[model samples]
Target: MSNAKSYIQTVALRDVKCYAFHGYYPEEQLTGIYFLVDVEVTFVHTGDTENLNHTVNYEVLNTILLEEMANSQKMLETVVRRILDRVLDTYSFLQTGKVGIRKLSPAMPGEVGHSFVELSYVAPK
Candidate 1:
């Protein structure tokens, strides 16, 4: 599909931390850092006012992000993919989504700013 035809929606959570094994270094597993996530969803709208069912629910998206954050993985990319997949699987209204995950205070000693990975996916028609 063409980009012009897509409808988009965004949800973001800033500065959330969960302890988990998310790094290559041994110390990383022992001590995890804060992670940030931002999600954007795109879908085709029928433009019917009564069709709330056809739209994505922001609350559900938030819950999914929270659940994914609580469950730690080895890579932020994996986490981002999982969150995107979870949303797509649960909500059919999303035709596409972009997910961004940031790892604050990475394992690098002098890394002053945050490190992050982002991924985008489009649902198959």
Candidate 2:
């Protein structure tokens, strides 16, 4: 059979809230902060969508999110990069993936809602 039947499937986990210690300052590191994470991935699939095996499991995604969030990093870039890398590595059929992490109520003098970073991946053909 031709590959014409193949289609792309996307899975996303949005606004995943977590409390973790991640910041540039030592004081901020000592005190944990709330975070919001969003993960989205698209994959090529030609098989029937009848089972979890047919697509990426979101539970696994959440687990990865929580695990990465728990690990304190100095930069939001590092955290988001790790999450994106993990997602792309986990699925062999992935076409593209994106991960965004936001720090809520950052340690800043001025009124700032949040600071964030986003990382994305695209599999080479």
| Model 2: per-residue Cα lDDT over 1-125, one tens digit each | 66567678889999999999988899878989999999999987757788888899999999999999999998889999888888777887788999998889887899989988898888887
- Of the candidates shown, which would achieve the greatest TM-score relative to the real structure? 2
- Quote model 1's TM-score: 0.77
Worst 10 residues of 1 by lDDT: 6-15
Encode model 1's per-residue lDDT on 1-125: one tens digit a residue: 56554445543444455545577676776787777778778776755546658677777888888888777677788888998899889876666787887777766679557887989887776
- In TM-score terms, candidate 2 sits at 0.92
Q: What are the models' TM-scores?
A: 0.77, 0.92
* Best candidate (score: lDDT): 2
The deviation in Å at residue 120 for candidate 1 is 0.6
Least accurate 10 contiguous residues by lDDT in model 2:
1-10
CA lDDT, every prediction?
Answer: 0.73, 0.89
